[model samples]
Target chain A: MAMAAFRREGRRLLLSPVSYNSSFAARSAILSYSELGPMGARSISTQAVRNRMKSVKNIQKITKAMKMVAASKLRSVQVRTENSRGFWQPFTALLGDNPSVDVKKNVIVTITSDKGLCGGINSTSVRVSKALYKLTSGPEKETKYVVLGEKGKVQLARDSKNSIEMNITELQKNPLNYTQVSVLADDILKNVEYDALRIIYNKYQSVVSFLPTVSTILSPETVEKESEAGGKLGILDSYEIEGGDTKAEVLQNLAEFQFSCVLFNASLENACSEMGARMSAMDSSSRNAGEMLDRLTLTYNRTRQASITTELIEIISGASALTGFSQSARATDNIQYRRYACMIKLQS
Target chain B: MASTAAAVPFWRAAGMTYISYSNICASLVRGCLKEPHRSEAVAREKVHFTVSKWADGKPEKPSVRSDSPEE
Candidate 1:
C-alpha cells in the first residue's frame, strides 16, 4: 500500500513538471509501456535514454531540413504550375473536355514523382489509374499504360506489367519545361497509338490538398468524327484558317500541340503537388518527432530520478541500521554493568 | 492571337515535324519571358540523359545524349 501510494505521488510530481493535461498521463503510460515491452527485464538506464534522445533529435533535424527544402521548392513549383496553366487551359477550352467520348484504343499516362516521402500522391495516382483502367477496359476497347516517373512505374508494374507500354523516369532530374515535356510527348505519341490519350496526374489544389485528375486528348480523326457526328467540333468550322491548311491538317496540328501543352502543364502541376505533399509530410513527421522527444525526455528523467531515489534510500537505510545496531549494543552493555553492580552490592 | 492569322508557321512551311515545330515555338515562348523566368526556363530545357532502345525483350547499350531546345 505504501509503495503504491509512493508511486502515485511520484507520478503526480512528474506530471506536474510536464504540465500536460490528465489525458497525457494515459498517453505517456501507453507510450512507456510499449517502449519498455521490447527491452524486457532490463532496467531503463540514463545512457540508453540519452542515446535514443540523440537519435530522435537527429531524425527531427533531418525532417526539419526536408520540410524547409520542400517548402522552398513548393514556392517555385507553385509559380510554374500557375504560369503553365495558360499553356494548357486554352487548349482544353478549345478542344473541350470529353471524358465520356468513346474511343477504340486508349493510352493512359500515369504521372507521378520519381522520388517519394511525399504523402500518398503517388499511390493515389496509381489507384486512380487502376480504377480508370477497370472502367475503360472492354472486349473491343484496348487500353495500354504509359507510366511516367519511376515511382508509378514500379507500382503499376506489379499488377499490370504486360499492359505498360512505356515507362519514363528521371524526367524531373531537371526542372520541367515546355521543350522537355514536348519532346517526351512526341516520343510517347510516336510509340503509342491511341484514339484518346488520358493523362492521369495529381492536381495541386493547395499546399495541404491535391486531387487526382485525368485529362483526355482525342486524336484528330476522333475529333473529326465527333465534329461530324456530335457537332462537338462545329465551332471549328467557323474558325478561319490563314495558312491554306485544310481543317484536318489544322486539327492534327492542334491535337499534337494540345497534347504537349497539356502534358507540360500536368507535369508541372504534379511536381507542385509532390513538393506540397512532401512539405506537409515532413512537417507532420517533425511534429511527431517532437512529441516523441518530449515523452522520451519525461521517461528519461523519471528513470534517472527513480535510480537516484533508490540509491539515496539504500544509503539512508544502511546508515540507520548501523546506528540502530550500535544502540542495541550500548543497551546490552548498560544491562551488563547494572547486573555487575547488583552482584557487588549483594556481596558487600 | 495576332500570330494566329500569320502565314503558316515557318516550321510547318519548312517541312518539320510537329515535334520540332512545337519545340521552336516553346523556345520562342521561353525567349519572350521576363528576366528571371526566361533564364530558369532556358536552363530547364537543357536536359541530358541516357536513352536505350529495347529489342527482343533486352535493353540495348545506353548512350549518353543531351537534348537541347534547339534541334
Candidate 2:
C-alpha cells in the first residue's frame, strides 16, 4: 500500500507543472477551433449568398422586362377590340336570340397562349371546358375540340386526346391580326362540321386578373332559322330588298364574317388577358426574389459578425498567453537559484 | 381583286398594325358591310345590301339590262 502511494506521488510530482500548463493550452486550442469553425462557415455562406443574389437579380430583370412588353401589347389589343365592336354588336344581337337545344353535336374552341409562366390562364380554360362538358357532352352527344395554343393542346389532350380536331401553335411568333382569324374561320368551316360552336378564352379583367369566358357563336343551322323569322315580328322585313343576294346567301356571308369577328375579338381579349396575367405573375416573382435577397443578406451579415468577434477574442487571449509564458520562464530561473542556495547550506 | 380593293378602304390597313396586315381585307369587309340601323354606316360598304354603286360613284346594278357599269 505504501509503495502504491509512492508511485502515485511520483507520477503527480512528474506531471504537475505540465498539467497546469496544459489547462491554458486546452483553452487556447478551444478558442482556435471555434475560430476556424465560424471562419470556414462565413466564407462559404458569403460565396453562396453572392451567387444566389446574382441569379435572383437576373430573374427579376427578365420578369420586369416581360411585364413592360405585356403592358404595351395589351394597349394595342384593346384598341383593335374596341374599334371592331361596330361590326360585331348588331350582328350579335340579330343572331344571339337563337333557340337553345339539347345539343347533340357541339364544338369547343379553347384559346390559350403558346408560352407558359403566365399563371393559370390555360388551365382555367380547360377547367371551364370540363364544366361545360356536362351540359353539351354525353353518350348521345359528340364534342369536338379546336385548340389555339400549345399549352391548351397539351392540357386538353391529356383528358380528351381523340376530341382535339385542330391543334394550332407557333402563333405568338407574330402578333394576331384579323386575316389570321378569318383564315382560321375559313379553315374550320371547310374542315369540321358542327351544330353549335363555343369559344372559351381568358377574358381580361385588369392588370391583375383574367377569367375564362364562354361565348356562343352563330352556327349555320341557327343562322338559317333566324333569317327565316327575319328579326322577330319582321323588324328587318321593312328594309327594301334590292340585292340579288338571297336571304340565305346574305346570311352565309354574314355567318362567315360573324365567325371571324368573334374569333378576332376573342383573340384580342385573350391576348390582353395573357399579357395581364403574365405581368402580374412576373410582378409577384420579382417581389419574391427581393424577399429572398433580404433574408440571405441578413444571414450573411450575422455570420460575418460572429466570425469577426471570435477572431478578436482569439487575438487578445493569444497576446496574454505570450506574456504569461515569459513571466513563468523567469520564475523558473529564480526557483533553480533557490535550490542551489539550499545545496550550499546542506554542505555547510 | 383590284376593283374590290378600291371599293374598300384598303388604306385603313397600313397605319395601325402592331401584329400583322394580312387580316386588313377581312377588317375592311367587316367594316363595309351594312349595319341595319345607322345612317353613316349605311353609306359605307354594305355586305348584305344591294350594291348601289362602286366607291368611284359608278353603278354596279345587276339587272337583266344594267349588267355592265357603262349601262
Candidate 3:
C-alpha cells in the first residue's frame, strides 16, 4: 500500500512540474526539418538553444534505441518470410495458369493483422481492397470478402456491400492449418459463384515501408505466359508437378492447394507489417516524451537559480544593517565607561 | 450469403481427410476418374496417413528405415 502511494506521489510530481510549459514550448518552437537541421539560420535564445540541444540529444537516444529493436525484429521476421517464399511460388504460379473452373463462385481472401499502429501498412491494404471491390462491382459478379483481421474487416466493411463471409481474428494464437484453409477453399470453390479470386496484403519491403499488393489468387490462365517466362529464366526444375494424375484433375487439386498456400503467405506478411508499424510508432512517441523532459529540466533550473539570488541579496542587506547597529552601540559603551571612570576619580 | 450444401455429404466433396465423411470418400474416388490431381493428392496423402498408424496402435514415422537391424 505504501509502495503504491509512493508511486502515485512520484507520478503526480512528474505530471505537475513547474516547468512543464517550457517543454511543450520547446517542441512548438521549431517546425520544419530544415530549421532543425544543420542548414537553418535562426539564432535562438541561449536558454531555448540549450533546451533544444538537450531535447535533440534526448530524441537521438530514443530513436537509436527504437531503431535497434526494429532491426532485431526485422531480422527474425525476414527469415520467416524468406523461408515461406519458395513454398508458395509454385502454388501461385500453377494457380496463375490453370483456368479449369468458373470464377463467378470465387472469394477474395484478405489477410491483415488484428492490431494497428504499423505505419500505413493496414491502410494501404485497405485501400487496395476498396479498389478491388470497385472493379468487381457489377450486378451479376458475385464477390464476397473473407477478412483475417478485425481492423481490415472494419475498414473493408465500410465500403463493401457484400456480406463478409468469414472473419478469422485468431491468426496469432492459431497456426493456420491446411484443414482450416481447405474448408474455406472448398466453400469458396463449391458454394459461391465467384469467377476469380484475389487477395490484398502488405508485402513487407523494409522496416519502414510495406507495399500494399493486390495478387490474383485464382484465374490460373493469366499465369501461363508468366510461368513459361519464369521457366525460361533457368529455375524451372522445382515448378514441375510430379504425379501420374490426369492433367485436368491434377490442375483442379493444384488450384486449391495453391490458393491455400497464397492465403497462408499473406497472413505471415501481415504479421510482419503490423509489428514493424508498431515499433516505428512507439519510437517516435518516446522521442517526443524525451524532448519534453529536457525543456522542463531547463526551466526548473532557471527558476531555482532566481530564487537563490533573491535569498542572497536579502541576507547581505541584513548583515550590513546589523554591523552598523552594533558599531554605534560599541562607541556608546566606550564613552560611558570613560565617563564612569572620570566621575569616580573626581569623587575620590 | 453463401449456400450450405447440407444435402451433399462432406466426404463427397473436396475436403481434407480428417473432417471428411465416409460417403464422400467413395464420391472422391469416383470423382478422381475425371479430376486426377484431386485423386492423386488424396491418394498420396492417404498412403502417408495409413503408414503412420502401426499394428500396435502406436504412431510411427512414414519413412521406411532401410538400416534397421531386423532388415
TM-score, chain A only, candidate 3, equals: 0.58
**Candidate 1 on A77-99: residue-level lDDT in tens?**
89989999998888877779888
lDDT of each: 0.76, 0.60, 0.52
| Model 2, position A19: C-alpha lDDT score | 54
Q: After superposition, how far is residue A284 of candidate 1 from its true place, in Å?
A: 0.5
Task: Please identify model 3 stretches exceeding 4 Å from their true place.
Answer: A1-74, A95-106, A159-162, A174-193, A219-247, A306-348, B1-71
Q: Which model is ahead, 1 or 3, in terms of DockQ? A: 1
Mark the regions of model 1 whose C-alpha exceeds 4 Å error after superposition.
A1-44, A325-348, B1-16, B25-41, B48-65
Write model 2 residue lDDT over A259-292, tens digit each, in one string: 7778777777787888878878888888888888
The lDDT-based order of candidates, best leading, equals 1, 2, 3
Q: Which ranges in model 2 have alpha carbons more than 4 Å from their true place?
A: A1-45, A97-101, A225-242, A323-348, B1-71
Q: Is model 3 an incorrect, acceptable, medium or high docking prediction? A: incorrect
Q: Is the docking of candidate 1 incorrect, acceptable, medium or high quality?
A: acceptable
Measured with C-alpha atoms, the lDDT of residue A13 in candidate 3 is 35
**Overall local distance difference test of candidate 1:** 0.76
Model 1 residue A308 CA deviation in Å: 0.7
